[model samples]
Target: MDALPRAAPRPHLPAGALGLGALLVLAYGIVPLTGTSYLFEALLTPFLALALAGLGLNLLTGYAGLLSLGSAAFMAVGAYAAFNLSLRLPGLPLPASLLLAGFVAALAGLAAGLPALRLRGFYLAVSTLAVQFFVAWALNRIGWISDDSPSGVITAPRLVVAGLSFDDPRGRYLVSLTVVTLLTLVAWRLVSSPTGRNLVAIRDNETAARLVGVKVARTKLLAFAASSFVIGIAGALWAFAYLRTVEPAGFNLDRSFQILFIVIIGGLGTLRGAFLGAGFIVVLPLLLARLGAALLGDGFDSGTLEMVQRIVLGALIVALLIREPAGLAALLDRAGRRLGRRAA
Candidate 1:
């Protein structure tokens, strides 16, 4: 018998399957819940926003191998920029405000990255820290950025789309889901492009990349700018869809660390990791709190619950890292591989 060419292994679900699955799950969760379950929708908005931000940070820190501690600051910049554009600029559209906020944060990222040519590792980290502080300080210094509001909360103006106002939780949730979906698609495309490969190359070995004629400095700066821009948009969405408040304290160092942890726990260098990490970071705490409340009842103090939650979270993170350093995505990938092998 003529040698039969083995049929190409069936490809995994076509590109975007994972994204579509997530969207379906999100939609399913959002659509059926009664009023009493609105908290899920509320919580999901910020979770998705933070996930988008973490995706950006992963591009910088994981793919480009640039350690940045100023992601939250960029997010803050976008939030405040959106606030100012919406409230201060006469006749500015909300979309315009979001774009302007992203642009402003990108500029900030570029400026911060310029010094990266001279510094890296700990030095680069420290320099980004300066950006964090500088942005926070600037936010506090300028009253206009805060909208001069006594409460420092930037309530989103009613989202008017073609004369329809989206003020309800369902509307806001839909908006967040749409924005996050589009951005995640963009991120997926970007990471699959030549520039993404270049960024990865530089991350692996800057000297080697330069030896091969890669524009090392430019690539690094672009990575930084791109990452910050995405993070900025996420921040804008966060402010508009959920918090409706833009405050300096909200985008502090702890926020930055939390994002870092998400990337680490999710799967550094992979877009899937961002979603996984965000889910763990966001849902885990809430789940734990609910469990604690159920077990301990009303008499259980918040402080004890908080402490136990932290300890459990810390232990989980450590366990995950030790067991699968590549994060949850890697675990999933391995499972798929095993399944494929079994099928073959």
Candidate 2:
């Protein structure tokens, strides 16, 4: 009998996965001990939520090649939906409310995605803009969604889950971190599945994908639904866990742009890019302000400094995009491969 080819041994864990796990452990376990309330509540929590949002968009645009600009609108849907569910049901649990909120967002995503069946590229993108505007307007005009608040705002309820209130800074950070971690894992798995392969095919060439028996419409809608589900949950976390306030303006076009930028700058198709881009988005402004203070001294005009910061940020983004069209994730990936090759 012919000798069977030797089977290659597989590593117990993928490269960087173990490092990521250890980093997460340190983040969840030791970082809280630092007792930096500002970093925890103001920075890390918000970054996590935004990273989740980026991951959601990345699923659609990165893997599926469906561009979206209304991520914030879906997020708003989730925030308001969860708020109303918890408020009206009274007995509804926080986890249930969050899940329901995601469902609501998914429904809305389907509604928005339906139009995508007929449209392509720029037209489809433009169509989603309508959803963004319409949702924002609805939140402002519709009294019931906002609980008829005089300010057109909804204050988030206490994030109580089975007698545990995540009201403290560390608690809130942990909650956000946990949710983001789970969702990230799920997304990783999703992108590795058969469905993910179909979506990528559809993205690379819709006609070829259709020829290969892929259901183009179905795959696209699923992408939208799945993306919106995660984004919606992130939105709920943004409201209940991070800001503790819900306002339509908070999830406006600017927020949409920010999320899109995170995806773009983080690396379109990679999951880790979301976090890297989000961290850049969150910390860059602070760093810019400090740089301004250090360079020009505290006596520098605040407005002028703000304008300078924006200019610098814009320039940096343009330069980075021009230098590495695939974003920072690709750069890191290439560097890692080079190091491995050298080590070998």
Tell me, by TM-score, which candidate is best: 2
Residue lDDT tens for model 2, 1-344: 54443222211122457887788778877898875999988799999999999999999988899888899999999899999999999999887888899999999999999988998888888998999999999998989998999657999887777899878888888888888988888888788778987988988999999998999999999999999999999999999889987778999988888899999998888888898899998898878778878988977677977787678868878998998998878777778889999999
> In model 1, which regions exceed 4 Å deviation?
1-40, 339-344
lDDT of 1 by residue, 1-344 (tens): 54454332322122247856876675657563543335635577778888989988998998899999998998998888887787777587666778788898888899989988989899999999999998888777777778776645566676655566666776777677777777777877777777887998998999999999999989989999999988998888788887775678889998888888889998888888888899888888788788888997986677887788789989999999999998888877888789999999
- Model 1: worst 10 consecutive residues (lDDT sum): 6-15
For candidate 1, report its TM-score.
Answer: 0.89
Work out how many backbone clashes candidate 1 has: 0
